[model samples]
Target chain A: MNSSLVFLIVFGVVILAVILIYNGIISRANAAQRAWANVITQERQKNKIIPHLQTITDQYQQFESGVQEKIAALRSALGGLSSEKMDTAKLAEVESATRNLVQGMHIAVENYPELKANELFGKLMREIAEQQENIGAAIRIFNQNVEAFNNGIEMFPHSLVNSLLNKKSTLHTFNDSEAEAGFDYKPNF
Target chain B: MDKASPSSENKQLATFLQSLRTQIYHAKTREDLRHVLHTVRSFGRPLCYNNTSYWLGFSMGILLGLLAILYAYWYPSSVSAPWLIGAGGLTSVIFAVLIYMRRSKVSDLSDALFKQDVYLDNNWQSVPYHGKKLAAQLSRQFSEFKRGNHSREIEWLVKGTYQGTDHQFDYHAYHFHYVDQRQVTSTIRDSKGNVRVTTRTVYDHFHRYGLYLPFRFARNIAITNSWFGGFFSSSYKPASVEFNRKFKVSASDELSAAKFLKPAVVVEIEDLGKALSGLNLEFNAASELCISFEQNICQWQRQHGLDEPDAFLQEIEGDQKLATLQKTLERIHTLMRHSDNNF
Candidate 1:
């Protein structure tokens, strides 16, 4: 009878430990998913500003035809993006394309200073800047959550529990060229 | 109401300061001293209280009087009434004399000299009659003015209009204070081995140097070194990673915040933040720009005696104070010009 009681206590402790670890992993996974949703939301918001840029830049097409064509190609490329299939690689591609679009706008503005005089153009410029800021913020938040999620499944007792019950994979963090080069710090001894 | 120009007002300040110095140095008779005190009081906020030693003396007297009474009551068989009365009476007389001497010293010319020193050091003046209206307008418009749980005060207000190269804007500068009370609970064991629990309310005072620019912004934006600025709704991270790490930017409209914080403006703000800790910048939709930072910015460290003509002259004649004022003005000008162009 005493042995049966000891067996029951150990069984209860193991079940509680597994439950706690399972809940922790699930919470981290949910947080990572929510953060990715935010990134997709910000990217879609950024896409809405492209039409405004096109309208203003179209009037100055004589000065920079190459910029206009690149912006047009970017809009179509973004149109086919599926939120469900969104990953860090696809997000990085969108980010680089957006940067190229902004660079083109800068070039167009430099070629035609008169474009800055238009009130619509000024407003559109501010909107684009805002979108760029939001996208950057969203990506950083997403990467932080992914790091947390990956850490949860890879650390000590959590790793043991994940291996036994929840076979989850580590998530990838989004990396832009600037972030990649900026964060890579190697010291010479 | 019409106001004097900054240059003209500064001239008046210089003239009045010189005359006060001369009067303080030459005063000999009590009447002459009274005249100096009157002039000092006219500048504002008079000191009417006695010194700390006087209060300490009175407190000691009260403690001794209470001890004498306690001794007599507890040891009725040992002490007599006459002895107790004599001790109490002697303590009262000593307390009265301390109060009288301290009051006389304070009422003479010491407070006047202290006030003069403060006036010169801070360049402070009495708030105008319309200052209430201005403070009220600020509380209504800016979120910073509306903060503080216990109390809020705006003092030493100075107003001037700066004529920039392309545009001109009015600025109101003041020292703002906010007080908050926090309750602290403490438990102690006394000499008799009895436990005591005491709860007291302690006050936390926050002092800020505030600059108000009565200009309109297209959108509301707040940037602060802390995440709890509580001025706006949404948080924004600009493209500058350094800025994101040091400061948190929030705005009601992200587009306007982006336009306002151009690269040049962000660099300027970062420099300012590095110079000053606890810096906060707010551009409200009410067409006002409020810049505030923790602690007093203007500091002068020279003191003069009433009879020392050289030190008095040196204090009055030095341009270090004016240079400090101009440096502050230049900083404000640079920030405003950047925001104006970008926004």
Candidate 2:
């Protein structure tokens, strides 16, 4: 082929490659954003479950003190507490306390058949379960995005741009507690 | 001759006829004749109590009307102007007195709803309650009721309970005053666990300006969280230094550390500060710096009349006071530089 014709062909190939890479990056970024949004939505939904659970427990006021203390602790931890300060030990403690509270409620329900049958109680349980699932899924998606983003930052050429934008590697992988807990188990009491 | 033979019987019959005629005449005059006519018209329906209240009310109403008319005429408008003025004044005075009495009654209802009498150390002090719930159910119900669904509010309050032995949880009762659709009057508990009273007057402060106050507030809260987290958790510690050196270091590196951290550390600090401040101000303005920050924001918003977006933006942009923020940041940067040089 003539020199001019060869140059045109190579330039066209390079443009196509760039377009493909751009699309891939855009998709990953969008997936990450969607994942974070899901996590936030799930968190809000989970927060909403507290009131309903409280109502069911109200009839058993004998358990209020213990439940109240647990609730107050959870509120302090989740409401505005920084994740940075939340070491593995503290996070585990919080998670365990929450699990225990749920277990306590399950035990309480076993004694009160009427509570278990209540429409509000049933609905609340379902919602809480769903929220937990959603949050887990969101976390997974977020981790995937974080991995991709971090990889992009570390990779040749892209790393330079990432540095200029001040983007750093984010900790999006599952924590040890999350890995140990596996999927959240539904309490049958 | 026949009449003479039964004179006693004829005389008794004549007397009975006269008595019957007199009874009919008296019935017609008394309007009892209408009752007799209606008896045939209805055939056999008995008089009912349905109209009893109506009839009694009608009579009483007529009497009142007559009395009112009589009073008005008794002191006729044609009478001297002085007399008319005196009567008018007296009537107004009476009306005012009645209104004052009614107002007190309404205030009592408001007080019961919004005031809490918390007993601590053998003394009862009045505190404001904003219907906050430790339980999730009650809080949702409170939020719903505040949104105007009163039925849910009552159901939640009646059914909601905290976990514990059912020792009468009277001390935990909260009160609320709906100052407006957005604002609330409440007493919050401070860091020292003392009650701090506050009136939160939520306006459309951001809606008009196309700003999201809640989001902004949340961002600030997040920043504070990260700051505290990093500060407390850091394994790295600097050697003991003079007060000046410590202050200088804090002003520079400590502040800049947040800026460089991944995921934007400053936002976390700002968010944490705003949230804590909001809570602190609501609970106790006397002890916490958050309350002072809130007060400053409130004053600035008020002075700038933030309801008008254009005016507010202009005020903030043109404000000389905002320069103080930049100056402070610069000073902190300078201190950090000095500390870095020393180290």
Candidate 3:
């Protein structure tokens, strides 16, 4: 075999490998954006369930749903949706309401063995706990995907096409403040 | 948002300005600021309110000038000319000067009060409409509205803020005198029974006054009061019987506009217009809601052929001015009340 032929084949194979690597990175970046959106959806669902759980807790008369302004915050957050268009203000409202409500539920049910023992109530609480756990899992998955996507955009070979894939929404959703330290900071009421 | 108070003599507004484009004067506790506007208007009788006297003065000047021209051209040379043309010239100058003097007083007074009552900077006292940035933003939102910046004289631009229990929003009262050149085509007939067509460019000055506000929405929308307005905009019908009757709201999509103009906000807007007499509000929406009405808020002495206007008056009752001001403030508050809430 000619030495030049071998070199050409090796060069062609290397180029093919680079093209596949670029495509893989692009796919990963897009997948990360979707995962981030899903995490936010989970947050919204958690917000939706919070009030119902608090109402149930209130019926038991065993714990206070530590929400200082439950009705107003919840009303503003829920009513503020204009057909899936939520401004940052509305998102903040929903986040604050949900955070407060969840915190209150946990506080009120701490020592209430009877309330916790109620089979149906126990199931509801467990469901809420599971959802809370899923929120963490979702956040972890989002952060992991974001880490991979960040590499795609920052790495030399893939950086060339990264601008095309850089969505403005990605920057907003992957706010370092929100995703850092195990998602410790939720919106404060 | 209580950044400045009316009484705090040194309420320098450089910091309160959003840019050179928008100036805001936040009254400390939100007292009735309309009294200030009323007191300013009533400071002196409206420059040309007495139509008969004004026209008579102007007509007399014209008569004098016409008489002088007649004396110069049509006077029989057989008789000694009394130089009546000079007299006519004097009359025109006197009439002009008199109008100039009164207008100057009125203009000056308005300036002084506009600065104080409206809580504006001294720099804004004579500002011509130079909201190029705002105009650009507006043009992007409403493709029909152009910023012919070549001949724009902005008289007053005030954005007032009212801090509510929860959030804060803004209402802008901005007015400008703009010049637009229009090509006019006309037909001419010659003595030889030949017809000719001619076109000439004419400059027209239009005063645009609007109470503009920004309302947050899910997306862009355009709403107007007239079909001509729809000529430049995609017509939007929310299909709510009351909304269609009261306003012509448009958007790129029907559903977005319909969803944005919630019945409750529409009611508030209607009530606001009713409260402010002579304010016929037209609606448009983008990232924010724009409640606009065409009513000149700027008072220019030169535009009125006056020298200076007054803001303080001694004899005339300010009741009418006060009433109008009250209504204006009420309307501003009503339309702008929820803007801070970002709904």
Candidate 4:
């Protein structure tokens, strides 16, 4: 084989390899960005539940105390929300408080047996449950993104780029107990 | 005419005087005085019954008579048989009388307890009654004794004292002492402190069980130290028995993956594409080493005319630096698990 022909073939192959690597990197970076956005979306959905919860709970003044206290605490923690540095521990506390408040409300409804059968309260509870599920889904997506980002920075070839860019992967996680238990709120009279 | 008029007037006057004297005499008898006095007393004075003294005297008399009979029976020969028998009959009569008296007294007290309108006095405390039945009845009627709430509060007060005979959880003892707003202090101590006290509210206590019996059982268990004995006795088994039992091992391929791979590798390569993107020349050095090692394996396979060259290539490619890191992590995990199991 001629030297010029060999050089041409080798050069083409290298170009194709570089393009493939670049495309893979770009697609991964985009996915990571999308995942971060999802985390924010979930957090917003969680926040939205607070007001509706408050409104529904307004009818039940006695039951509102615990729920209100938890909501206030959660709001304070989430005030300066940043997806880049979400505190896993704080999130866990918020999640737990939310669950306990839900339980408290459920118990309170037992006093007024008719309240459990109230259309508004029932709808509100269902909505809150759905919102919680959505938040969980969002958190999972965010964690998935974080895992991808961390992998890219730590994997071969991409690790070199990650180091050069000085980019660190954020940890996105939910409370293990909460995730396992799945929003337990049992009512007893 | 004058003589005849004077005789009739004189005869009429005598008859009138005789009738007035007879009526006056008839009104002053013993029965009439007695009736008048009774009426006066009934209207003027309150009916007085010394309940405490009455009961005490009656009970003491019965006790003394019983003692006398017992003494006579012990020294039968010292006393005449007829005399002893007579005394015994007399004692029995007294005893029967005392019992009747006691029952009537109790009935009177019960009526009083029921009829008396208890007002929340300035002290905000209930007046202590002499009779137990009276006190209990008064407490029920006057105290704000709602079934659920009051029972719950009382349960909280009595939780560790009552243990049910069934279940291991019942065999725990608890002690609780608290002073209420009335300054009435109560202390419940379970000498056998085997009970596990829980923070479950009174509502929960009842809701968990259908009736008060189970609740009482749970409470007694909480209060008693004997609960542990009961708990263990109900399900007594030797350590050897537990050890002898074979654990069924269910084969799970997914679970096996968790056992083989290091946690770090699974965690790091969870997003393989992103990890590859993050890697640059420096990070790729590890991958290059892996690739070179794989290439050598491939070359060796080619020279040897190995039928499964691709399989060997896959094995080499899959066993990256991440896998090595995972293996190290796995070793640490295994060591931790072993320590935990030993503990």
| Model 4, C-alpha of B110: deviation from truth (Å) | 80
The C-alpha RMSD in Å for every predicted model, in order, reads 13.2, 27.6, 21.7, 36.9
Q: What's the lDDT for residue A189 in model 3?
A: 27
- Better structure of 1 and 4 per lDDT: 1
User: Weakest 10 consecutive residues, lDDT, candidate 1 chain B?
Assistant: B43-52
Error of 2 at A121 (Å): 3.0
Q: DockQ for each of the predicted structures, in order?
A: 0.04, 0.02, 0.01, 0.02
Expressed as tens digits, the lDDT of each residue in B186-224 for candidate 1 is 999999999999999999997778677775534588888
TM-score of chain B of 4: 0.15
How far residue A160's Cα lies from its native spot in candidate 4, in Å, is 4.6
Residue-wise C-alpha lDDT for candidate 2, range B91-190, written one tens digit per residue: 5555555445534432432222111111111122333322333223432322211222121111111111112221111122122222223667898998
* C-alpha TM-scores of all predictions: 0.47, 0.28, 0.39, 0.31
- Candidate 4 off by > 4 Å: A84-90, A160-189, B1-343
Rank candidates, TM-score, best first. Answer: 1, 3, 4, 2
Query: Over the stretch A1-189, how does candidate 3's per-residue lDDT look in tens digits?
Result: 999999999999977866776676766655665555544565555555555656665777545434435635665675564324324345455556656665665665676656666655565555555445445544455555666666666776666545554332232233333324477567762
Tens digit of per-residue lDDT, candidate 3, span B142-239: 43345353455545576655344333555565665567888899999999999999999888876656645555534455555433334224565431
True contacts kept of each: 0.00, 0.00, 0.00, 0.00
The total number of steric clashes, by the backbone 3 Å criterion, in model 1 comes to 2
Candidate order, lDDT descending: 1, 3, 4, 2
Better of 2 and 4 by TM-score: 4
